[model samples]
Target: MPKALSEHETEAFRERICDCAARLYVEEGPAAVTMRRIATDLGCGTMTPYRYYPNKESIMTAVRTRGMHRFSQVLEDALGSPGDGRTRSRAVRDAYIAFARANTATYRLMFEYPEPHKDDTAYREAHERMLRTVVAHVDVMIDEGRIQADAPIFGHQIWAALHGAVMLEIAGMLPPGFDAASLHTRTVTALIDSARPPAP
Candidate 1:
């Protein structure tokens, strides 16, 4: 009989499976992400992937959950960096764009892909963690009197703007010489300025 995989080996293999699944889903859409396809891509037996993941949906959930946690960490690191509110806000914005560009496929999976199991605990918690990171940054600005707006509302607005810019860049929809970074910077700065209290 074959020796069982060590716990670390098991986790490594799971990550490999998720990486393969994410690429297939991004490149060919959900229809292409079958268990057989994943196994074939990994050069394993057809049933090998099934041993690790019960179904395609579970694999996709794992992929998305992993992506969200990684994304949240990037944002959290930027938020936690030593800086004033405006500086830290820009850091988070830059980190958001950087992550999207670097992990376009995973980014799409996290936001663009339809989640049939939206209530899945891991995915939902990761989603909420990301949301809280954004709102917490906004709260920092508000506490410093940098802006006066509802944390959740302003957080959503900022998130919407950044996501729109990133999506356009990802889709190659932005016109020539108009990059997502510049657009993001300008839009976020304008939003922050708009929320500022009037000068006495």
Candidate 2:
């Protein structure tokens, strides 16, 4: 009998499976991302992927989770640089847009396609953690007296604006002569401006 994989090795193997599955998802849509296909691509027996992931939904969850983990780190590093609240907010917004554009396939797989009625606990929690990261920055703005709104509400507004712009750009729906990067910067600026206290 073969020796069982160590914990670390198991995790690495699982990530490999998710990587293949995610690529197949992006290249051929969700229908082509079957466990057997992943196993075949990985040169393993059909049961191998099944052992790691019970079904396509679980693999999709893993793919989404991996994308979220990497994206969360990008947001962290972007906000880690020395800056004021406004500067940090702008950095975070730009980082968000960059992540979307660079990882268009993974981004679309994560958001554009939905897996309904599936137990996506890890994906949902990772999503909330990303939101909390944004909220923390908004809290900084509020505490600095730069904004006059609920931090969570304002954070969500920032997310909404960024998401809309990125999605529109990705779908090629932006108008001719429209500059997405400029629009992204302006959108973040406008959100901050909206939160500013009116001049007395």
Best prediction by lDDT = 1
Give me candidate 1's TM-score against the actual structure: 0.93
lDDT of 2 by residue, 1-37 (tens): 9899999999999988877877788889778988778
Instruction: Give the alpha carbon lDDT tens digit for every residue of 1-200 in model 1.
Output: 88999999999999899989888999998899999999999999999998899999999999888888889999999999898998988889889999998888889888887878889998899888877886678999999999999999999999999899999998899878888888878888899889999998
Clash count in backbone of candidate 1: 0
Q: lDDT score, residue 88, model 2?
A: 83
Task: Give lDDT per model, in order.
Answer: 0.90, 0.80
Off by over 4 Å in 1: none
Task: Measure candidate 1: CA RMSD.
Answer: 1.5
What residue runs in model 2 are displaced by over 4 Å at the alpha carbon?
Answer: 1-9, 117-120, 173-179
